[model samples]
Structures are given as C-alpha cells and as structure tokens.
Target: MFALVDCNNFYASCERLFRPDLQGRPIVVLSNNDGCVVARSAEAKRLGIKMAVPLFQVQEQIDRENVAVFSSNYALYGDISARVMTILEQEAPAVEVYSIDEAFLDLSGLAPHFSLVEYGLQIKRRVYQYTGIHVSVGIAPTKTLAKLANHAAKQYPATQGVVDLSDPQRQRRLLGLMPLREVWGVGRRLSRRLEQQGVTTALALADCSPAWIRSHYSVTLERTVRELNGQPCMELEACPPPRQQILCSRSFSHRITEYNDMRSAIAQYSARAAEKLREQNHLARVVTVFIRTNPHSQHERFYSNSASRILGVPSADSRRLTATALRLLKSIWQPGHRYMKAGLMLSDLYLPGHFQPSLFEAPESPAAMRLMQTVDNINHSGLGQVRFAGELLSSGWQMQRNHLSPAYTTRWDQLPVVRA
Candidate 1:
C-alpha cells in the first residue's frame, strides 16, 4: 500500500500559521518581486481571485474583499516545510518527498495492526497539533491511485481529508469520476490528445491496452495505466536522486542597467548554486550566466543573452564558481539595457569522490573546505550571514518583497511576540 500526503494551500497556510487572526480570510501569496499570485486561500479562490494573476489587475477585488496579501518569504516557507517533512518521515515506514508540500509514504505492512483510515487520521491530527498545517492523506495500492485518492480527499469535504482506495470497486468508481488530466502522469497536452480519442476519464485511460498506450504515447503512460489498475509500478524512494542541474535566479526588485550591479546579482546567484552543489556532495564542471531585460516593456529595446564556461576542474567551491560566473557575466552583459533578471546555472555534475581525478590537478584543499563549512554553519544558524566580496552589500539587486511576512521561525528578531 501507498499513501500521499499533501499540505493544503501550502504557501497561504504557512502565512496563516502564525497569524491566527487571518483564519477563514481571503489571502494570497505573490511570487518573486511580488509579480503574480502563486498561492491562494480557499476564500480567495471563492472570490474569483485566479492563480498567477498580476497584483495590479486584482487590486480592486482585493480591496473590495479585504484580502490579505504577502510577498514570497522562502526562508519562512522552507523552514516550515522542513518541519512538516520531519513529521511525515517520523510517522511513515518509508517516505518520498515529492515536493515542498507533498510526500508519498509506504504503508505495505502496517495494516495487520491498525486500520489505514485511522492511521491516516492520526497523521493529520499529529501534523496539525505539531505544525499547525492541515494535510490531506490518500491511501491506495499504487502511486497513481494514491494521488487520485488524495484529490478526492481535497475536493470533497465530507471525506474530511482522508480517502482510501484499497477496494477495487471503490477505486474504479472514483477513477470513473476523475477527469483524465487529473490522473498522476497525464499532462495538459496528453489530456487533449486523450480527449480527442474519446478517453476523457481516468477509467477510460486505464481500460486502454497497456501495449497500445506504450506505442501510441509513451512507456510512462503505459506504467500509469497499469498503476491505475491497482498494480504498483513505482516504489517509494527514501533518498531522492541528485539533481542534474542546479539553478539560482530571481527577478530584481527594480531594473538594473549598470554592468557592475548585474555582476553582483550573478555572483550572489552563483554562490547559492554552489551551496546547493556542496549540500548534495557533487561537483559541477560547467557554469552559465543569463541576464535579460523586460520583454513586456514596449518602450525599451529588448535584450537577453547567456554565456557558459567550462571549469578547468569540476568544483563546488563558492569562491571559484563566483569568479567563473563573473567572467561569464562580463562576456554576455550588454550595457545600457535595463535588465529585469539575472541568474546562474551549474551543470555537468559528478559526485565528489567518484569522479576520476586528473594526474596534474590538485584536489580541493582541506583549508578551503573548512572555511566554507564554517561560513555555511553560520548562515544555517540564522545568527548572521557572511558573504564573498563580489556579493556587494546594498547592491540594490534584491527582489521586491513589500508585503512579506516576518520570518517567524528562522529569524531571532522576527520571532512572534506574545502580549498579555
């Protein structure tokens, strides 16, 4: 058996975690630079506030409905997500964290001792008691059916956020009611093609021949079809696979034209990308820098460019990545253009101890590794932050976050204040 647990309105729920006064209120969290709606509360959705809608276009509706707005605070969201994942990991035999707000759990052996529905209720209660985040749990024999069960839990309030599809009859009925696109692996394009072929529901897709689905669409869709028939085609992965690429980019709070300011943004992004590489214990042989002006601005001539450089040796050292990124930035940056965004990408990754070393090249120095570890420790502690020289203080490259909530869990000064 498998179970899928998903946090309800993840970003909005995180915002409401500390602000109890906003319960049952309409709220929305904006994306980077407060650009567009990324997450909305149920009340906000009821008010016809669509996802990804620009704030300017919804300002009147927001005012009329007294909607709460917030800028994206990743530090806050990441901390809360870590806590939620911790609870899930402790409760389940094996867990696969699918996303920041979703996880899959293995429940193959526990049924002999306890009811699966009761166990699901326990997970919900414990998570809410500990983290103040509501979650929906869906249990089934396969990952595909687990996802479908989770969708049913979320859509129908009578389920109370728990649905089990272990019974074949119930699974078929639920799949019959589900749109084809709502299946785990069917995407928008696949859904359209399936619709044209008169396969518009989950049951319709599952009823197709597995070999026919594989030949017409893909092996992945064939696996989805089998899984929908209650056969397990995927297993829970306790350890996630290493990322093939690491990217760090963000839209700036304001447009930048000067090459030096853009250099600072690239350097910051490279440092972040390097941190991720080190966290995963991998090295990157290629670094790329990209910068672009706002294409939507009709008054200015549009410009966008990117350049990649191969490192002499694959490395996860921030200092080396930052220097390489600055060189790439210099090669691609066009002066006199108002750049809206800049970022860095690290690719061609290899595990640190597994890759063959060059006969002439020296290995990473212990002193350099120690220094980076110390810096990372300080930053992770949230006591203070240390930066490389290229990451200039007051660089004016920060993203817009005018309506950001306080970092209630990660920052010392921003801790929630209690008054009598």
Candidate 2:
C-alpha cells in the first residue's frame, strides 16, 4: 500500500500561518512580479477567482470581496514545506517528496498491522499540531489511486481530510465517480481525448487494456491505467533524478534601458542558478544568458537574444557562473531596447566526479570547492547576507513583490511575534 499526503492551499496556508487573523478569509497568492494569481484559498475559489487570472483583471473583484492578497513568499513557503516534510519523515517508513506540498509514503507491511484510515488521520493530526498546516491524506493499493483518494479527501469536507481507498470496491466506486481529468497524469487535453473515445471516467480508463492504452496514447498513460487498477507500476523514489539544467530568471518590476541594470540582473540570476547546481551536487559545463523586451508592450519594439558560453571546465562555483553570465549578457545586449526580463541557464550538468576534463583543463580545485562550500553555507544560513559584488540587484531591477509576507520561518529578524 501507498499513502499520499498533500498540503491544502499551500501558499495561502503559509501566508496565514503567521497571520492567524486571516484564517477563513479569501486569499490569493500572486505569481512572480505580481503577474497573476498562482494560488487561491478556498474562499477565493468560491468567489470565482480563477487560477492564472491577471492581477489587474481581478483587482475590482478582489477589492470588493476584501481578499487577503499576497505576492509569492517562497522563502516562507520553502521553510514551511521543509518543516512539514520533516514531521512526515518521522511518521512514515519511507517517503517520496513528490513536490513542495505533497509526499508519498510506503506503507508496505504496516497496512496489515493497523487501520490505514486511522494511520492517515494520525499523520494529519500530527502534521497540523506541529506545523499548523492542514494536510489531506489518501491511502490505497497504488500511488495513482492514493492520489485520487487524496483529491477526494480535499474536495469533500465530510472526509475530514482523510480518505482510504484500500478496498477494491471503494477504489472502483471512487474511480467511477471521478472524472478522467482528476486522475493523476491525465490533463485536460488527454482527458478530452479519452472522453471522446468513451473512456470518460477514471474507471473507464482503468478498464482499458494496458497494451491498448499504450498503443493509443503512450507508455506513461498505460502505467497510469495500471496503477489506477490497484497495480503499483511506480515505486517510492527516495531520491529524485537530477535535473539536466538549472534556470533562475524573473521579469523585472519595471523595464530598464540601461546596460548596468541588465548586467546586474543577469549576474544575480547566474548566481542563483549556480547555487541550485551546487545544492543538487552537479557541475554545469554550459552557461546561457538571455535578455528580452516586454512581448506584451505595444510601444516598445520587442527584442530578444541569448548567448551561450562553454566553461573551460565544468564547475559549480558561483563566481565562475556569474562572470560567464555577465560576459554573455554583454554580447547579446542592445542598448536601445527596454529590457523587461533577463535570465541565466546552466546546462550540460554532470555529477562532480563523472566529468573527465581534458589534459590542459581541470575541474575546480579542492580548496576552491571548499571555499565555495563555505560561502554557500554562510549564504544559506544567513538568507543571502553574503554574496558576490555583482549580485546586487540594481535599483528597480528586482521583481515586484509589493505584498510579500515576512520570512517568518527562515529569517531570524522576520520571526513571528506574539502578545498576550
């Protein structure tokens, strides 16, 4: 058996964690640069605020409804997510961190030892008690069904945030009732294709032959079908596969036409991407920098260009990445355009020992690597207090985060305060 636990309205919940007064209020978390609605609380959903709706488009409705608006507070959310995952790690034998707000647990022999429903409820209670975050738990014979059960747990209030579909009959009933789109791995396009073929429900897709599904759709879809039918095609991944590329980029709060501002933005992005590479223990051989004018602007002539640099040797050192990114920025930058966005991408990633350098070139020295590690440690511990000189964000070059919440869990100065 497998169980999936998912945080409910994660970003909104994180915002409400420190501001208890905001509980039960409509909340909307905007995307980078306050571009659009990325997350909405249940109350916001009830107000018909659709996901990805531009902030300007819903300003009137949000103001009239008195919605608690927030920019994406990722530092707070990431810290909260880590705390929740830590609590979960203690409860489950093995856990797969599915995403920032979801995890799957392996319940192999435990199912026969105890009631899965009770176990799910226990996890929910413990997590909430420890982190003040409500989570929905779903248990089933397979991961895919476990995800469906989780969906039901969150969709229906009567479940009390815990649902068990371990029974075959219960699985079939839920599958029948669930639309194909709700099934894991099935998106709107695939759901419509399946519905047109008369496989309109989760059970209908499950009933289709695995080979037939594979031939008609793809192998991944076939695995989903099998998993839906109580067969576990996927196992708990303790360590997720490494990414081939790391990108750090964001649209500026406002456009800039200066060279120094664009260079500053690219340098910051490069440092961020390199930091991610080090976090994953990978070294990148190729660095690509890109700059672009606002595509949506009618007054400005849209210009976009990108340049790539091959490192002398693969390295995860931040200084090297930032320097390369700045040089690349210089090549593609045109002075006249109002640059709206700039970014860095580090590709050709490989594990530290896996890359064999040429005779003339060598990887980063052990001492240099240690120095980088020390710097990373300091920056991580201090929420980016230590950094390269080029990393400073030029005035007005940063993303628009007008409604950002304090980094309550990660930053000491931003810790929550209480009064009696």
Candidate 3:
C-alpha cells in the first residue's frame, strides 16, 4: 500500500505557525517582487481572491475585503518544510518527499499492525503537535489512486484526513465522480482530448482502450491508466537526484532602465544559481542571461533579450560564472528599454570534479580552491555572505523584500522569549 500526505495551505500554514494571531483570518502570500498571489488561506479563497491574481488588479478588492497580505518568506517556509519532513521520517518506515509540502510513505507491510485510517490520524496528530499545521492523508494500492484518494480526503471532512480507495466498489464509485482533469497525469489538453472522445471522468478514462491511448497520447498516459487500475508503474525512489538545470530569476519591484542596474540584477541571479550548483556538487558549461520588459503596461514597450556563453570548462566557481554572466548581460543589454525582469540559467551540468579538463582554460589552483571553500564556509556559518565578488555588494542592485516576519528560527537576535 502507498499513502500520500499533503499539508493544507502550506505557505499560509507556515506563516500561522509563528503568528498564531493569523489563525482563521484571510491571508495571502505574494510572489517574488510582490507581483501576484501565489498562496492563499481558506478565508482568502472564500472571498474569491483567485490564485495568481495580479496584485495591482486585486488591490482594491483586497482593501475592500480586508485581506491580510504578506510578501514571500522562503526562509521561514523552507525551515517549516524541513521540520514537517523530519516528523514524517520518524513516523514512517520509508518516505518519499514529493514536493515542498507533500510526501509519500510506503505502508505495504504495516497493515498487519494497525488500520490505515488510524495510522493516518496518528500522523496528522503528530505533525500538528510539532508544527501547528494540518495535513491530509490518502491510502491506495497504487500511487495514482493514492493521489486521487488524497484529493477526496481534502474535500470530505468525514474522511478525517484519510481516504482509502483500495476496495474495488469504492474505487469505481469515487473515480466516477471525480472530473477527468483531477486525475494524476491528465492535463488540460489531455482532459479536453479525453472529453472530445466522450471520456469525461476518471473511471471513463481508466476504462478506455490501452492501445488507443498508447497511439493517441504518450506511454505515460497508458501507465497512468494501469496505475489507476491498481498496477504500480511508478516506484518510490529513496534519493532523487538534483535538478539538471538551475535557474534563478526574478522580476524587479520596479522597472530598471539603467544598464548598470540590469547588470547587477543578472549578476545577482547568476551568483545565486552558482551557489545552488555548488551545493549539489555540480557545474554548468552553458550560462544564459535574459531580460524582459513589462508585458502588461500599455505605456511600456515589449522587449526581451537573451545571450548564452559557453565556458571553456564547466565551473561552479561564483567568480568565473558571474564574470561570464556579466559579459552575456552586456551583449544582450539594450539602452532604451525599461527592463522589468532578468534571470540566469545554468545548463549542460555535470559533477564538479568529474568534468573533462579543457586544454585552453587553466585548472583551478590550490589557492583559488581554498579561497572558494573559505568563502562558502563563512557564508554558511553566518559570518557574512559571499562578498568576495564586487557585483554582490554593488550599490545598484535592489534588496530582496522579505522584511515582514521576525526571524523567529534562523537568526539569534530574533529568537522568541519564554518565561522560566
């Protein structure tokens, strides 16, 4: 058996963890640069504040509805996610972290000990006790059905955070009621195609001919059907590999017209991407920089640009990547356009120490390696950030907007007090 555990309103719940005052209030977390609504509490959704609604478009509605808004605080969210995962690891024998707020636990052998519903309730209670966040769990014989069962558990309160779809009659009944698009692998395009074929529900899709599905759509869709029918096509991997492409980009709070400011933004993004690359022990041979103007403003011109540079040798070094990224920025930089966003993408990645040495570029010296190690250690220890590069401390770059919440968990100065 497989079980899916998903946190309800993950980002908003993270905020409520520290600020208990926000419980039952309308709350929303903005995306980068305070651009749009990325996450909303149940109360906010009750007011019909749709997800991804632009902040400017909903500003008046927000004020009229008395909605409480917050900028994205990833540090707090990441910390809370870690805590949740830690609790899960202790309770489950084998666990797979599906996303920032979701996980799958293998329950194949534990059925002899306790009922599935009781096991799920214990998990929910323990997670809430540790983190003050609520979660829902679903159990099924296959991963696809487990996901569907989880969706059902969220909607029906009688399930009490646990829905089991292993029974044949119950599985058919539940699948018949669920919309086709709610299935794990059926996207909007596939859903429309399935509807055109007169298959409008999960049960209908599952009953479709496998040969036709294989011919019309991908093999993945065929696998989804098998999984829906209680055949496990997907196995839980213990340790998934890191991502191959690392992209770090953001829209500015305000449009940037100056070339220096654009360069600084690009450099900052490249430095961040490089940090992630180093963390995963990988390096990239290709670096891409791009800038774009606001597409929504009628007064602004729509302009976008990109430039790619191939490194002589793949590198995770911040200095090398930032220098190459700045050069790419200069190539794509246009003088007159007001750029609203910029980003950096590092691709063609490989393990750091395993790359083929290039004859043209000199290998990293001992001194350089030591300096990089020292810089990374100091940043990790909170002595200071990576300031060896001038671009990091340049005056033209804008500050990140994570100013609202007190640093309750990370910083020593922001720790909460307790009476003895």
Candidate 4:
C-alpha cells in the first residue's frame, strides 16, 4: 500500500503557526510583488476570493470583507515544511517527498501489522504536535488512488483526516462519486474529452476500453488507467537524484527604471542559483536570465526579455557559472525600461562527478578545491553570501519585503516561549 500525506492550506497554515490570533480569520498570501492572491485560507475561500486573483481586481472585496492579508513568507513556510517532513520521516518506514506540502509513504509491508486508519491518525497527531499543522492521509493500493483518497479525506469531515481505499467496494463508490476532473492526470482538456465520450466520473474513465485509451492517448494514459484500477504502474523511488534544472527568481516590490538596478537583481538571483547548483553537486552548460515589467500595472510600460549563454564546459563552480550568468544578463538587459522582476535559470545540467573533463581546460589544484569548500561552508553557516574575485556587488537591489517573521524554530533567539 501507498499513503499520500498532504498539508491543509499550507501557506495559510504557516502564517497561523506564528500568529495564532489569525486562527479563525480569513487569511490570504499574495504572490511576488504582492500582485495577486496565491494562497487562501478556508475563511477566505468562503468569501469567494479566487487563487491568482489580481490584487487590484479584489482589493475592494478584500477590504470590505476584512480579510487578513500577508506577503508571501517563504522562509516561514519552508521551515514549517521541513518540520512536517521530519515528523513523517520518524513515523513512516520510508517517505518520498512529493512536494513542499505533500509526501508518499510506503505502507506495503506494514498493513498486516496494524490498522492503517489508526496508524494514519497517529501520524496526523504527531505532525500536529511538532509543527502545529494539520495533514490528511489517504491509503490505497496505488499512488493514483492514494491521491484520490487524500482529496476525499480533505473534502469530507467524517474522514477526520484519514481515508483508506483498500476495499474494492468503497474504492468503486468513491470513484463513482468523484468528478473526472478531480482525478490526478485529468485536466481541463482531458476532462472535457472524457465528458464528451460519456465518461463524466472517475469510475466511468476506469471502465473505458483500454484499447481505445491506448490508441487515443500515449502509453502514459494507459498506465494511469491501470493505476486507477489498483494495479501499481509506478514503483516507489528511493533517493531520487537531484533536479536537472534550478531557477531562482522573484518580482520586485516596485517597477525598476534603471539598468543598473536590473543588473543588481539578476546578479543576486544568479548567485543564489549558483549556490544551489554547488549544493546539489550539479553542473550547468546553459545559463538563462530573464527580466519583465508588470503585466497588470496599467500605468507602467510592459517589457519582457530573456537571454541564454552556453559554456565551453559544464561546471558547478560558482565563479564560472556566475560569470556566464552576468554575461547573459548583459545580453538581455535593456535601457530605459521599467522592470518588475528578474530571474536566473541554470539548465543542461549534469552531476559534477559525472562530467566529462575538457582536454584544454586545466584542472583545479587541491588548494583551489579547499578554497571553494571554504566559501561554501561559510555561506552554508549563514556568515555571508558567495564572494568571488571578479564579481562586484551592486548597491541598487530590491529587498525581501516579507522577511519580518520571527524564526521561531530555526534560530535560538526566535524560539517559542513557554510558561513554567
């Protein structure tokens, strides 16, 4: 069996973890530059505030409704996600982190040992105790059904945060009641197609002819069908390797009018991307930098730009990657344009140890390796960011606006208080 564990209203819950006063209030987290609503609490949802609703479009409604608004506080959310995952790691035998707010646990061998529903309740209680966040667990024979069961658990109150679909009759009934669009792989296009074919529910799709699905869609769709029928098409992956692409980006609080300011933002984003590349022991042959003006601001001019540079050799070295990134920024940068956001993307990635050496380029000496290690260590320890000989710091950079939250879990100074 596989169990899918998902956090409820992750971003909003993160906010409540710190400010307990907002527990029952309508809360919403805005997107970069506070442009739109990216996340909404249950109360906010009840007010009919949609996700990605532009701030200007809903400002009147939000004000009239007295909704509690917050800028995207990623630091707090990331820390909370880590804590939640740590709790799951201790309770489950093995866990695959599916996303920031979701994970899949292997429960194949443990099903006979204990009741799955009881075990899931224990997990929910422990996670809440440690992180002050609520989670919903779904158990099924396959990942797809587990995901469906998880959604059901979250939708209905009687489940009380746990749902098991191991029984065939219960699985069929739930699938029959669930909308086709609610299934994992069925999106708007596919859902419409399925509806046109008289398949409006998940059970209907599961009962479709396999030959027709194979002929119309790819083998991937066929596998989804099998997984929905309790045949596991996907195996549990342990220690999946690092990502092949890394991106670091954010929108500025206000439109930037100067070219130097744009360069500064790109440089900072590139430095962050480079640090991640080194941390994961990955090398990139291509560096991409992009800049854009706000699309929603009627008063400002709109401009979008992107530039890419290919390196002679793939490298995880910060100096080489940052140099390429800056060059890419130079190519993409425009004069006299107001930019709202800029980002750095590293692609054509490969593991550093697996990289093929160039015959012409000289290898780094032991001293050079030690120096790179020192820089990485210092940055990791939070002393300072990356520093290189050729790189010059730019003064005009956008500041992170939502960094005011207390680091209650990660830092000693910000730890929560308790009365003796």
Candidate 5:
C-alpha cells in the first residue's frame, strides 16, 4: 500500500501559520521577485486571484478586495517543510519526498488488521498538531492512485482530508467520475488527445491495454495506466537522483542599463550557483550567463542573449565561477537596453573524485574542498555569511521585493515578538 501526504495551500498556509488572525482571510503568496501569484488561499481563490497571474495584472483587484499579499519567503517555507517532513519520517514506515509540499509513504509492511483510513487520519492530525500546517492524506494500492486519492481528499471536505482507495472497487468508482486530466501523470495536452480518442475519464484510460498504450504514447504514460489499474509500476525512491544542472536566475525588481550593475548581478548569481554545485559535492565544467529585457513591458522591445564558456578544469570554487561568469557577462553586455533579468547556469557537472583530470588541467585541491565546506557550514549555521571579493556588497542589480515577509523561523533577528 502507498500513502501520499500533501500540505494544504502550502505557501499561503505558511504565511498564516504564525498569524492566527489571518484565518479565513484572502491571502496570496507571490513568486520570487514578487513577479506573479504562486499560491492562493481559499478566500483568495473565491476572490478570483488566478494562479501564476502577474502581480501587476491583479494589483487593482487585490487592493479593491483588500487581499493580503506576501512575497515568497523561502527561508520560512523551507523551515516549515523540514518540520513537516521530519514528522512524517517518524510517523511512517518508509517515506519518499515527492515535492516540497508532498510526500509518499509505504504502508504495506503494516499488520493486516490495521485500519488504513484511521492511520491516514492520524497522519493528518499529527502534522497539524505539531506544525500548525494542515495536510491531506491519501492511501491507495498504487502511487498514482494515491495521488488521485489526495486530490479527492483536497477537493471534497466530506472525506475530512483523508481518502483510502485500497479496494479495487473503490478505485473504479473514483476513476469513473474523475476526468482524464486528473490522472497523476496526464497533462493538459495529453488529456486533450486522450479525450479525442474517447478516453474521457480516468477509468476509460485505465481500461486500455498496456501494450496499446505503450505503442501509442510513451513508456511513461503506459506506466501511468498500469498504475491506475492497481498495478504498482512506480516504486518509492528513497534517494532521489542528483540534479544534472544548476541554474539560478531572478527577474530584477527594476530595469538596469549599466555594465557595472550587470556584472554585480552575474557575480552574485555565480556565487549562488557554485554554492549549490558544492552542496551536491559536484564540480561543473561549463558556465553560462544570460541577460534579458522584460518581456511584458509594453513600450520596450524584448531582448535576451546568453553566452557559455567551458572551464579548463571542473571546479566548484565560487571565485573561479564568479570570474568566468563576469567574463561571459562582459561579452554579452548591451548598452542602454534596460536589462531586467540576469542569471547563471552551471552544467556538465561531475561528482568530486568521479572523473580523472586532464593532463594540463589541475583539479581543486583538498584544502579548497575543505574551505568550501567550512564556508557552507558557517552560512548554514546562521552565524555569518562568506562571500567572494568579486561580489558587490550593494546588491543594486538584485531583484527588489517590496512585500517580503520576515524569515520568522530561520533568522534570529526576525523572530516575532509578543508582549503584554
């Protein structure tokens, strides 16, 4: 058996976690740089705040509705997510973190007499009890069905946020009423194609022959169909695959037209990308940088350009990455174009000690690795931050966020204060 636990309105919930007065309020969380609406609370949805809509497009509506808006507070969200996952790891037999807002559990090892529905309810209760974040629990025979059950848990309150589809009969009943697009892996385009082919419901797609599905669509879709039919085609991944590439980019809060500003932004982004590369214990051989004008600006012409350079040696050193990125930025720098975004991508990554160095190229020394490790430890400990000389102190090129919330849980200085 499989169980999926998903946080309810994750970002918006995080914002309201410490603010009980916000209960039933219309709240929306904006994406990084305050560019768009990424998460909306139940009240916000009722107010017609669409997901991914640009903040500018809905600014008037938000004000008129007196909607509460918050910029993405990643530090707070990550901390809360960790707390929720930690609770799950202790509550379940085996666990797989499917996303920041979702996790799956293995319940096959439980005693046959144990009640799946009751256990799912317990998970839902404990997560809320400990973290003040509500979650929906779905239990099914297969992971795909578990995902569907989770959707049902969220859609209908009658379930009380717990749904179990272990019985084949119950699975059929739910799938018969579910649209093709609601199936775990079926996307919009795929759902449209399946609808045209007369597979309008999840049950219809599930009834198709696996062989025929494989020949018509991809092996992935075939697996989805098999899983929908109560066959476990996908197993829990205890350890997720390592990322092949790391890219860090952000839309600037304001337009920039100067060369120095672009250099500053790329320098900081490179340092960030290198930090991630080292976090994964990998080194990158290729460095790419890009800058662009705002695509949504009506009066300005859209412009974007990118440049990449291969490193002489794979290295995760921030100094080296920053230098390479600055050089790339110099090559692509355009004068008076009003660049609104800049970023860096590190690719062709290799785990440390996994590959041989070229005859003329020298690998990063052991001391260098230890240095980066120490820097990371210091930064993570919240004691202080380490930076390269090339990175500018004043982040003028950085994306400005006007409505950012305090990092209540992560930053010592930002903690909320209560007084009599």
Candidate 6:
C-alpha cells in the first residue's frame, strides 16, 4: 500500500501558524512581488478567488471579504515542510518526498501489523499536534489511486481528511466520479485531448484499451491507466536519485543594467548550484550562465543570451563554479538593456568517485575538499550568512518579496512573539 500525505493550504497554513487569529478566515498567499494568488485557504476558495489570479484585479473583493493576504514566506514554509517531512519519516518505514507539501509513504508491509486507516489517522494527528498544520492522508494500493483518495479527502469534509481505497468497489466508484483532469498523471492539455476521445473521467481513461492508449498517447499514459486500474506501476522511492543537473535562477525585484550586478547575480546562482552539487556528492563538468531582459516590458528592447563552458576538470567547489559563472556572464552581459533575470546551470553531473580523471589537470586536493565542506557546514548552520567575495552585499537583482512575512521559524529575530 501507498499513502499520500499532503499539507492543507500549506503556505496559508504557515502564515496562520504565527497568526492564529486568521484561522477559519479567508486567506490567500501571493506569489513573488505580490504578483498573483498562489495559495488560498478554504474560506478564500469558498469566496471563488481562483489561484494565479492577479492581485490587483481582486483587491476590491479581498477588501470586501476581509481576506488575510500574505506574501510567500518560503523560509517559514521550508522550515515547516522539513518538520512535517521529519515526522513522516519517523512514523513511516519509507517515505518519498514528492514535494515540499506532499509525500508518499510505503505502507504495504505495515498493513498486516495494524489497521492502515487507523495508522493514517495517527500520522495525521501527530503531524498536527507537532507542527500546528493539518494534513490529508489517502491510502491505496497504488500511488495514482492514493493521489485520487487524497483528493477526495480534501474535497469532502465528511472523510475528515483520511481516505483508504483498498476496497475495489470504493476505488472504482471514486475513480468513476472524478474528472479526468483530477487524476495524478493527467494535466489540462491531456485532459482536453482525452475528453475529445470520450474519456472524461478517471474510470473512463482507465477503461480504455492499454494498447490503444500506448499507440496514441504514449507509454506514460498506458502506465497511468494500469496504475488507475489498481496495479502498482510506481513504487515509493525511499532515497531520491542523484540529480543529473542543478539549476539556480530567479527573477530580480527590479531590472538591472550594470555588468557588476549581473555578475553578482550569476555568481550567487552558481554558488547555490555548487552547494547543491556537493550536498548530493556529485561533480559537474559543465556550467551554463544565462541572462535576459524582461520580455513583459514592451517599450524596452528585449535581450537574452546564455553561454556554457566545460570545465578543464570537474569539481564541486563553489569558488571555481562562481568564477566560471562570472566569466560566462561577462561574455553574455549586454549594456543598456535592463536585465530582469539571470541564472546558472550545473550539468553533466557525475558521482564523486566514478568520473574519468583528467590527464592534464591535477585531481582536487583533499585540503580544498575540506575547505568546501567547512564552508558548506558553516553556511548551513548560519542560514547562508557566508558568501564568496564575488557576490554583492546588496544586489539589485534580489527577488521582489515586498509583502513577505518574517522567517519566523528560521530567523532568531523573527521568532513568534508570546504575549503575557
């Protein structure tokens, strides 16, 4: 059996964790720059304020409805997500962290020891008790069905956020009732295409001939069909596989035109990507730097360029990556155009001990490895206070988070205040 555990209105819930007064009230979390609605509480959803709607368009409604609005507080959300994932890992024998707000647990072997539904309830309760965040759990024989059960748990309050679909009849009935778009593998475009083929429901898609589905849509769709039919095509992955590439990029809070600022942004991104590479114990042989002017600014001329370099020798050191990224940025950086975004990608990743050695270049020194590890440890412990000299103290290219809430969980100064 597989169980999907998903946080309920995760961003809004994180905001409400510090502001308990917002409970049972309409709340919405905005995207970066307070651009659009990225998350909404149940009350906000009830008011029919859809996700991704521009904030300006709904300001009147938000005021009239007295909805609590917050900017994305990723630091708080990340810390809370880590706590929730830790609890899941402690309770479940194996857990696959699907996203920041969701995970899949392998519960097949534990079914014989206890009631799965009861176990799910225990997990849900423990998570709430520990984190002050509510979660919905859905258990089924396959990941796809588990996803559907989770949807039902969230959609219907009578389920109380726990649903088990081990029974074939119940699984079939739920699948029959759900729209094609609600299935785990189906997206908007695929849902529209499937609808054109007269497969408008999960059950309808599952009932289609596997051969025909494969011939038309692809093997992935066929696998979804089988999984929907109660076969376990996807299994819980206890450990995430090493990433083949690591990308670090972000849109700037304001457009930047200076070469130094662009170099600073790319340096920062490269350093971040290199840290990720070291965390996964991988070496990247290639680094790509990309820069772009805002396309949305129609009055200004648009410009975008990317440059890639293959390192003489693969290394996970942030200093080397940052240097290479800065060099590449110098090549692509254009004057006069305001750059809206810049990024770095570390690719051609290889395991530490498995890569081919360069004949001309010397192997990375043990001292350098220790230094990198020390820097990483210090930064991790200090919440990313350490930085390379190439990084700017205050780059204009920082993300626009105008309405961001304090990092209550991660920052000492922003810790929740307790009233006497």
Name the candidate that leads on lDDT: 1
> What's the lDDT for residue 394 in model 5?
49
What is the lDDT, from 0 to 100, of the residue 413 in candidate 2? 86
lDDT of each: 0.91, 0.90, 0.85, 0.82, 0.89, 0.89
Candidate 6 or 3, higher lDDT: 6
lDDT for each residue of candidate 4 in 31-137, tens digit (9 for 90 to 100)? 87677889999999999999999988998988898888888777678888988988888887889998899999999888888999999999999999888899999
Q: For each candidate, C-alpha RMSD in Å?
A: 1.3, 1.3, 2.3, 2.7, 1.6, 1.5
RMSD over all Cα atoms, model 3: 2.3
Q: For residues 72-127, write the lDDT of model 1, one tens digit per residue.
A: 98988999999999999899889999999999999998888989999999999999
Range of the 10 consecutive residues with the lowest summed lDDT in candidate 4: 388-397
Report the alpha-carbon TM-score of model 2 versus the true structure: 0.97
Q: How far off is residue 106 in model 2, in Å?
A: 0.8
Model 4 collision count: 0
Q: Model 2 Cα RMSD, Å?
A: 1.3
Question: Model 2 has how many clashing residue pairs?
Answer: 0
Better of 3 and 5 by TM-score: 5
Per-prediction TM-score: 0.97, 0.97, 0.93, 0.91, 0.96, 0.97
Q: How far is candidate 5 from the true structure (C-alpha RMSD, Å)?
A: 1.6
How would you encode candidate 5's per-residue C-alpha lDDT over 75-158 as one tens digit per residue? 899999999999999987788999999999988867386888899888988999999999999899899999999999999999
Regions of model 3 farther than 4 Å from truth? 296-301, 360-370, 392-403, 417-420
- Which parts of model 6 have CA positions greater than 4 angstroms off? none
Candidate 5, position 308, lDDT: 98
